[model samples]
Target: MTWETGGKSEEPDGAGRRDPAPPPVGGILWSVAGDIRVLLTLPSALTMQVAHPAVGAGVDTYSVFRTDPWGRGERSLRSAQLWVYGGEEAAEEGRRLRRLHRTIQGTDTRGRPYHALMPANYAWVHATGFPVFRHASAYLQRRPYTPAEERQLYAEWLRVGRILGIHDRDMPQTLEEFWPYYRRMLAEELELTAVADELTSVDRPVPPPDRGPLALRLPLRLLWPVLFPPIARFRRFATIGLMPPDAREAIGLPWTDAQERRLRALGRVVRVVVPLLPERLRYLPLARRARARARRPG
Candidate 1:
C-alpha cells in the first residue's frame, strides 16, 4: 500500500503500483516540453483541458483565471517547467498539485457533480497535451516528429502523467490505445463548456500585467487597451487553430483554410527564428537553469 523513496513513504498509485516518477532528464520530454514553442500551443492545451465538463466547472468555479490571469498563468507555467526540469522537486510539485485539487469539487453546468481529482477528469487534462504537442510541432518545428519519435514522446508523456498522479488504468497506455480513447472522449465527453468558450473568445477582457514594478505596471495599464486587441486575437487564433482538427470539430469551433495557411506561415517563421536564439533565450527559465547545471563539470 506504500512505496518508499528519498526516505519518504508514499501511497501506492491507482493501479496499485509504486509511484511512477517524473520523466528522466535529457529525455524526449526534456527536449520537447521545455521549449519556448510550447508556450505558443499552451493555450490550445488549456482550452482542450477545460472543454471537459468537470474540468471546466472546477476551473470556472475555483480558478482565479478571471481575476489574476497573469499570475495564474505564471504559476501554471512555473509548475509545468518544474515538472520537466526540477529533478526531485518535480515529484513534490506533482504532490502539491494533487493536494491543491483535493478540494475542487462542484456540480457542473449540466447539474452533474464533478471533482478535479476524479480519475477521468485528471487523466483527460494530462492527455490533451500530447496531441496538442504533436499537432503544434508540425507548425513549430521544421517537421513534425517522426513516427518513432512520436512513440518515444508519448511514452515520455505517460511518465509525466504518472508524475501528476494519473493511473496507468485511467489513461491509455500506448499510442494505439490513446487515439481511440482520445476520439471517444472527443465524441462523448468533450463539449463547448462555458469556460472553454470564454477562453477562446477574442473579445474577452484581460487586464494588464500586474507582476513587475509599479512604475512599469502603471504605464502598461494605461497602454493595455491599445495593446490588448492584437494579443487577444492571437490568443484566440492559437487556441482554436492549434487544436487537433477532430477536437475543433467536436467542439464546433471553425478553422478556415486561410487561417491554416496563416498559421503555417507563422510556424515557418517560428521554426526559423527560435533555434537561432541562445539557450538562455530559447528555453524557459527553469529549463535554461537546468541545462546550465547539466553542462557544468560534475
Candidate 2:
C-alpha cells in the first residue's frame, strides 16, 4: 500500500492502515526544544551524524551540503522543527525523509554496504539530541538538570527518534543508558571522513535567518556576510567544547588554549543574554507556529 504526503507517495506494509505517528513532544520537550539557545549545540549534533561512515558516505553521495551549506542546513533545521512540532506535518515529514532515504543505500569507500535507514545511523542521530537537551537546559537555566528531568527529556527524544524511523527497541531508555552508548560510539564508531572534515571546516558563509522588517533585514543583510567568518570560526570552537573529548579527538578537530578561552566566553555571553529578550524575540517564529499546530493536533 502507499501513502501520499507533501505531493510524494510512500509504500506501507501489506496492511493499508499505518501505525499512527507519535504525539509531538510537549511538556518537557517543548520547554527544552523551543529555546533558540538550543542552537548553540547544533554544530556538535551535526558533526556526530557524519562521523558515522555510512552517514558520511550517504551525505556525500546524496546531499548538496558543501556547495550550498546555508540552504542545506536551513532545510534540515526546518524539517527537524516540523518533525518535532508540526503535528500531522511532523508525521508527513517522517514519511518524506523515509522515502528520500530509501534510495540512498550503497557501498562505502572500503567496500562496506551502508544504508541511511539502518537503526545504528538513525540511533546515532537521535543520541545527539541527548546532549542538546542536557546543555540547553543547563545553559538556559544556569544549572544542571535534575535526574528526573534528564530521564523525561531522554524519553521525549526517543519519541522524536520514532518519528525519524528509529525503533524503540534499538534506542536507550534513560539518561544512564545513553551515556554508555554515546561513549562507546565515540570511542569505536566515529571517524573523520574527508567529507566530514570539509563540513566541519565550513567552506561558505552562513546567511542570516528571515527576520521580519525591512529595517532589521536590510542592516542584517549588509552586516551578516561581514560577520559570518568570525561567527563560523566561533562555531568551530563551540562545537569542540560541546563534544565529548573522545569524539573531538577522533574527528581531528583542534581544541587549543585560545579556542577554549573563546568558547567559554562565547557560552557565557549567549547563555546570559539571549533569554532576556522579550519572549517573542527569544525563539524562532516557525517554532511558535509549529507549537500552536501541535497543540491542536487531530
Q: List runs of model 1 lying over 4 Å from the truth.
A: 1-19, 213-215
Estimate candidate 2's alpha-carbon lDDT, on a 0 to 1 scale. 0.67
Give lDDT tens digits, candidate 2, residues 1-298. Answer: 0011122346652234354454445657676465677666776777777777777787777776655555566667777776556766666677677776676777765578987778787678668767755764554445777888777767777777777767778888776777898888878778887666765674544557454576787787888877778877767766667765667787777777776666667667877887687767776666777666656949
Among the numbered candidates, top TM-score falls to 1
Give the C-alpha miss distance for residue 231 in model 1, angstroms.
Answer: 0.8
Pairs that collide, model 2: none
Local distance difference test, each candidate: 0.83, 0.67
Residue 168, candidate 1: alpha-carbon lDDT: 88
Q: Give the per-residue Cα lDDT of candidate 1 at 235.
A: 90
User: What is the per-residue lDDT of model 1 for residues 52-75, given as tens digits with 9 covering 90 to 100?
Assistant: 888888888888889888878888
Candidate closest to the true structure, highest lDDT: 1
